[model samples]
Every structure is written in structure tokens, then in C-alpha cells.
Target: MSAFLRSRLLWPVVILIGLVALNVAFTDHFLRIQVKDGHLYGSLIDILRFGTPLILVSLGMTLVIATKGIDLSVGSIVAIAGALACVQISDLDDQNSVSGVLIAVGITLVLSLALGAWNGFLVAGVGIQPIIATLILMVSGRGLAQLIADGQIITINSSPYKLIGGGYWLTLPFSIFIVVALVALTAFLTRRLALGMFIEAVGGNAEASRLSGIRSRGVLIVVYTFCALCAGIAGLMISSNVSSADSNYAGLWIELDAILAVVIGGTSLAGGRFSISGTILGALIIQTLTTTIYSIGVPPETTLLFKALVVTIVCLLQSPAFRKRVARKRPRPPVTQTPVPVSDREPVTNR
Candidate 1:
């Protein structure tokens, strides 16, 4: 039982189960699902809806962390993308026009890609620390967003744009669907192409990986680019949801949240390994914790404190020292031995 509990899969599974149990205990209708306007309605649905964007960002974060890197600019990239998209749409008479929306999306994508490449170049080519390189954008990305929006929120009245963030399909939020599909696609590509192994190798030892013919620089570039793209998608979802883009609020502090999710999901901050499934579970845990707080009528002012405590607890639990202490606290099984006469008889026979 101790061995089983210590398995890599154990903590994540336990946490997931604990969250589910908490929901069931706290909410009268935690798992109760109902059809409303041909769509599902329930707390479970809400969890997925709120969790999608975080999941997306954390997915990219997992990769970056795997390579012993961090992308602080992800949150800023999100703002930039949303700001650009909203600015483009703001020029149109009707924000709902398909052509205008497409153009905005294209522009956002391009800008995000470029920004990602810039970060990659600094980190990979110029050998800048990932944190410092991304910090440059983290500081300026919001300013750029404000500049694009002319220091004002850019409002749009477009259904297509709304659909990206707020629309529904099969009774579930479209954002949730997008997140699920992306997760599946990413998992497949990484696992099928053996990219996971390669990524792990790069993260585990860059110098060794390079000597072994792996293109570490190229890998970093791709990882940064992917992180930016994820941020871009998150921006689109968030901007679309409000029908307006506010650079200030679009993705403020999201980089922190993504990093937390990745860490809580069992990915090491020191890098070298990752778990997509674990990251997803970590996102869910965060969303659920938020929901739990709101549902229980916790004061808004205390929410931050609660979150801080939770994070601290999770981090401590992941520590080897804590695990060792816990192991020491467990009762040891009594040792057993063969009778002395039986042992002597066996020894004589052998001789």
C-alpha cells in the first residue's frame, strides 16, 4: 500500500478524487446535470469552462518548464493578441462581420508568432536567461496592448468573435471544446512522434543533448513559439467572451497562474520531465478550488489568502523531505523469521 501510494500517478489521482469528493460534499447538486435549452448545465460544466484557458497556458508552460525555461511573456502575449484583435475589429462598423474577424485573427496570430520568435531568439540565440528575456515582454506587452487600444477598451459586437469565447456546442462551452481538442492533438503529436522523449532529453541535459545531435536551440525556439501561440488562443477566447478587449485585464497575472498549474501538476520547476495529463488535472484543481471558494461564500478579500495557503501546501507536499517525514511516520510491519531449529536443519542438509 505504501509503495502504491508513492507511485507517480498516486498523488494526482488522489487529489482529483479529493476534489470530486469535496464538490459532492459542499454542493447539494455537485454532479447533478440537467438539460437546459438543449445544453448541459451543472457545476462540472462550469469547471471546464473556467479551466480551459488556464489549461491551454499550462500546456505550453509544461513544455517550457520541461526545458528548464519559463515564459513570463505568455500573459502579455495574451493581452497583445486580444488588443490587436480588438483594435482590428473596432475599426469595423459591425464587429460580427466574418471578414473583419478573420483579419483580426490573422493579425493577432502573426503578431503573436513574431513576439514568440523574439523571445526565443533572445533566450536561445543570445543566451539570455528565460526569465529575464520574457520579463522584457511582460513589462512591455501590456503597454503595447494599451497603445493598440489607444488606452481604452475596444468593444466589438460580433457573434463570430463571441463564439470563440462564449459560444456553445453540444451543450458545452466552445472554449472547453477547443481546449479539449488542443490537448488531445498535443498529446497525440508529442507521444506519437517521440517528441516527448526528445524534449525530456533536451531538458535533462542541454549540452549532452546537443552533443548527441539534438538541436537544442531549435527546440527552445519551437517551445517559445508554441507558448506564444497558446497565449494568443487564450487571448482570443477572453476577448471574445467580453465582446470587448481591455489590455489591463485580458490576462493579467496569468503567467503566474500557468506556472503554478504546471508546478502543481507535478512538473518540476528544475525541469527535465513533464506530464500533460497532470497539467490538465492541475488546472482542474485550481478551477475547482476557485469554484469551491465562491460556492462556500468565502469573502472576496480572503480569496487570495486562501489560494496562497493552498499553493503553499501543495508545494510542501511535493517536497522530498516532506515525503520522507511522512514515510517515517508510518508504522513499520513486524519482521518475521524462520524458527532456529528449522534453519539449522536446512543448513545441515545443504552441507
Candidate 2:
């Protein structure tokens, strides 16, 4: 039992199970399933639906963290993507058509790629710190988005656009399908190739990896690019959901949430290791926790406080010092002593 508990996979599994149990206990019919419009409906389905964007961002985040880097500009990129997409659609009268929507999505994708390249160049070529580099975008991307939208929220009345964020297929939200597809693709790429190992090696020791001819700079660039692309995808989903582009709130504070999800999933902030499955689980946990809070009628003002407390507890539990203290508190078996009557008598005679 002790050996099983100490296994690396045990904690994450336990955490996932515990969260599921908590949701079942606290929420009314947490996993209850129903049919609507010939589609499945349930709280679990809702959790996945809402969690898609976070899961996407965290997937990219896992890669960045594995390369010992961070991207704070994802939220901004999301804003930028939405803004660009809306601006493109605003110029067209038939914004509800397939062609217009495709054009907007394409434009957003291109812009996101360029923005990612800029971040990658700064971090990899100019030797800027990842946080500082991304922070610049985090601040400027919104401004850029606002500029594109002419400081107005561009309303989109497009079926295709709505489908991106709010549509359903086969009794499940399309966003959920997108997230699953991306997760599977990412898992395949990382697992089937040398990318995961290379990223981990670079994060573990950049100098050593470079010495071994791993092209660390190139890896960093790719990581940033991937992060930006994920942010772009998330932007599409969010903007589509509202059928409007509001740069101000499109993806506000999303980067922080992604970071939290990654950390909660047991991915080290300091880097060198990552877990895609764990990140997906972590995203679900966050969504479920949020739902649980709202279902119980917790005030909006106190939600942040509750989330903070949960994060604090999870972090503390993961701390090495806490683990060591727990280990020290465990009882040790006693040793028994044997009698030595003959030896005691011989020693007395010698004295």
C-alpha cells in the first residue's frame, strides 16, 4: 500500500478521483444525463464544454513549461484573434456566411502566428526573459485589438461563427470535440516524436542540451509559437460564443488560469517535466470546482477567495518540506534486546 501510494501516478489519480467524488456529493445529480434535441445533456458535459479553452491553453502551457519558459501573452493573443476576426467580418454585409467566417478565421490565424513569431524572436534571438517578453504582448495585444475594433465591440451575427463556440454535434458541444482532437494530436506528436524528450532535456539543462547540439533556441521558438496558436484557438471559441468581439474581456486573466491548471496538474513551474493527461484532469477539476461553487450559491465576491484557498492547499501539499514532515511523523518499529547472563557474570569476575 505504501509503495503504491508513493508511485508518481498515484497522486494525480487520487486528486482526480477526489474531485469527482466531491462534485457528486455537493451538487444535485452531478452526473445526471438527459436527452435534449436528440443530444446528451449533463453537468459533466457542461464541465467539459466550458473547460475546452482552458484545456487548450494549458496544453500549450505544458509544452512551454517543459521548455522552462512561460507565455503570459496568451490572453492577449486571444483578444487579438477575436478582434481581428470581428474586424474582418464587420466589413462584410453577409457576415453570416461560410466564406466570410473562413476569411475571418484565416486572418486571425495569420495574425496570431505573426504575434507568436515576434514573441519567439524576442525570447530566443534577443535573449529577453520569457515573462518580460510575453508581458509586452499581454499589455499591447489588447491595445492592438481595440485598435482593430475601433474601440468598439463588433457584433457578429453568423451561424458559422456561433457554431465555433456554441454549436453541438453528436450530442456534444463542438468545442469539446475540438479540444479532444487537439489534445489527441498533441499527445500523438509529443509521444511519437523526440519533441517531448528534447523539450524536457532543454528545460532540465539548457547549457547541456545546447552542448549536445539540441538547438535550444529553436525549441524555445516552437514552444512560444505553439502557445500563441493555442491562444488563438481559444479566442475563436470565446468570441464565437458571444458573437461579438470585446477586446477588454475576451480572455482576461486566462493566462493565469492556464498556469494554475498546469501547476495543479502536477506539472512543475520550474520545468523539466509535463503531463498532458494530468493537465486535462486539472482543467476539469477547476471547471467542476467553479460549477460547484456557483451551484451552492456562493457569492461572486467570495469565489476568488475560495479558489485561492484551494490552490494554497494543493500547493502546500505538493511542497517537499510538507512531505518530509509527514514522513517524519510516521511511527518506526521498536528493536528488542536479548539477555546476556553468562557475559554479565564473566565481566563481573574480570572486574
Candidate 3:
């Protein structure tokens, strides 16, 4: 029980649950869901639906960060992915055609895979710092997306494309299915197949891992590529949900959010062991925080500050160093010893 309480995951879970309960108590509709026209609609559904993108991106990030690398380019990749896909669809003879949608998605994902490999190459092969390397793309990717989109937002009403984000199936959001599948696939690959161990080994000590026969470069490439792929999917959902792609606004600052989720989910920034389950929870908590902020009627300008305050509190609570300092600051209970009465005192014996 003590070990379980001490686990990194415990605090995030507790914070999430506490926030949820508070929301549930304060908002009548927070947990309410209704089915209309065979489609589920409600706050719970929206949370699951809107939170899917974060879940996917953070899952990928868990791997990248676990390998002591960060991809700041994910948000730009998100914009690029959706922009390219929409551009292709708009130019098609039938924008709503499934074939056109499939082609657009496939092309966008292929490009995303290539971009991810580029990041990996710079970091692993060229030895550039991950932040600087990804930042190059992060800045350029938006411009590239704007160029592809002709410096305008691309809007389309393709039903097939809409299904990726706004559609419903099985009386719930279809996006939930995507989230579940990706989560399961990631867990299987990392946990069951032991990919996580290799990542941890690399992150914990890259030279040691290479000496132990682990191919660090290959792992870096795969993880970065995977991160890009996840960002691409998120891009698709974001653009599809709104039926438009805005190079300037689409996925702006999402990479920060994903990194925050990964950190809040119990993954260390220094890199080593990671927890996908914790990342998922972290993503959900972030979405919930957004909802709570809106529900609390905070001003739009103040929302970011409010959210940051909450996040800071949570992060400090989760930080081992912060916790140690707090523990040290707390005064210990004074050790109280009662003096025995003279009659009740035991006789002193000298050997």
C-alpha cells in the first residue's frame, strides 16, 4: 500500500479524480450524456472526443521523451498534415469521395513519416540538440503548410474526412475508437514486446545501451517517426472537426500541451522509464482542466493564467524534489517523553 501510494502515478490519478469530482459536483451537465439520432452527445462524450488528439500525441511523446529526446515540431506537423490532406481533397474532382479522402490521408501520413525521420536524423545522426533540431521544423513547418494551403485556410465538407473527428458510431464518438486502438497498440508494442525497456535503457544511458547491443539510432528514428505519425493523426482530427485547416492557428502550442501531459503523467523530463497509462490520464486531466476553466466562467484572457496556476500546483505536487523540500520544511512532531512518577519509576540498576 505504501509503495502504491508512493508510485509516480498515484498523485496524477488522485488529482484527476479530485478535479472530476469537483466538476461533477459543481456542474449539472458535466457528466450528463444524451443520445439523439443514434448519436451520443454530452460533456462526457466531448471530453473523450476532443481529448483524443492529445492522447495520441502524448502517447508518442512518452516514447520520444523516454529516449531523452523532445519533438517541438509536433504542432507544426499537425498543421502541415491537415493542411496537405485538405489541399488534396479540395483539388479532387469529388472532395467527398472516399477514395480522395483515403489518398489525401495516406499522402499526408507519408509526408509526416518522412518529416519525423528528418528530426530523428538530425538528433541521432547529426547530433544536433533535439530542441534546436525540431525547432527548425517547428518554425518552417507552419510556413510550409501555409505554402501548400496557399496562405489560406482550406475548408472542405467531405463526409469521409469528417468521420475522423465529428462522426459517431456505436452510440459514441468515433474518435474514441481511434484513441483506444492507438493506446492499445502502443501498450502492446512497448510493454508486451519490451520496446519500453530498450527506450529506458537508451534514455538512462545511451552509451551503455549501445555497448549492451541496443541500436540507439534505430530506436531514435522509430520513436521520432512514431511521434510524427501521431501528430499527423491529431492534425487530421483537428482540421476535420472544424472542416478547415488554418496554418496559423491549427495545433498552435499543442506540442507544449503534450509535453505538459507527458510530464504530469509521471514521465521524467530527464528521460528513463515512462508510463503510457499515465500519459493517457494526463491528457484527460488537461482536457478536463480546459472544461473546468470554461465552466468556472473565467475570462478568456485569464484562462491561460488560471490553467497554468493549476498545472503548476499539480506539477509541484508530483515533483519528487519539490516534495522532498516540502517534507523537510514541515516541522516534525516534538518527541514527548513522560517522566515516570517517583513510585512508578523503575529502580536504576548499575552494572
Q: Quick one: best TM-score, which candidate? A: 3
**Full ranking by TM-score:** 3, 2, 1
Between prediction 1 and prediction 2, the one with superior lDDT is 1
> Best candidate, lDDT-wise?
3
Worst 10 residues of 1 by lDDT: 342-351
Off by over 4 Å in 2: 1-9, 330-351
Local accuracy of candidate 2 as per-residue lDDT tens digits, 162-252: 8887899888899988988888888888888988888899899999999999999988888888889999999999988888999999999
Tens-digit lDDT track of model 1 for 1-351: 898577555665676677688778878989998999988889898788877888999998899899999999998888889889988888888877999899889989888889988998999999999999999999999999999899998888888888888889878899988898888888987788877777888889999999999999998898888889889999999888888898988898888989988888888888798989888878887888888888777799999998888777777776778888887866789999957776567444653
Model 2: lDDT equals: 0.85
Q: Which regions of candidate 1 deviate over 4 angstroms?
A: 1-6, 329-351
Q: Residue 174 lDDT in model 2?
A: 93
Candidate ranking under lDDT, highest first, comes to 3, 1, 2
Error of 2 at 193 (Å): 0.6
lDDT for each residue of candidate 3 in 1-351, tens digit (9 for 90 to 100): 999798888989999988888789878877778889998888878888999999988988999999998999999999999999999999988888998899899999999999999999999999999999999999999999999999998989899999998888888888889989988998899899968889999999999999999999999999999999999999999998998999999989999999999999999989999999889989999999998888768899999999899899999999989988878866789999998899998899999
lDDT of each: 0.86, 0.85, 0.92
The TM-score between candidate 3 and the true structure equals 0.93
- Roughly what TM-score does model 1 have, to 2 decimal places? 0.90
Residue pairs clashing in model 2 are: none
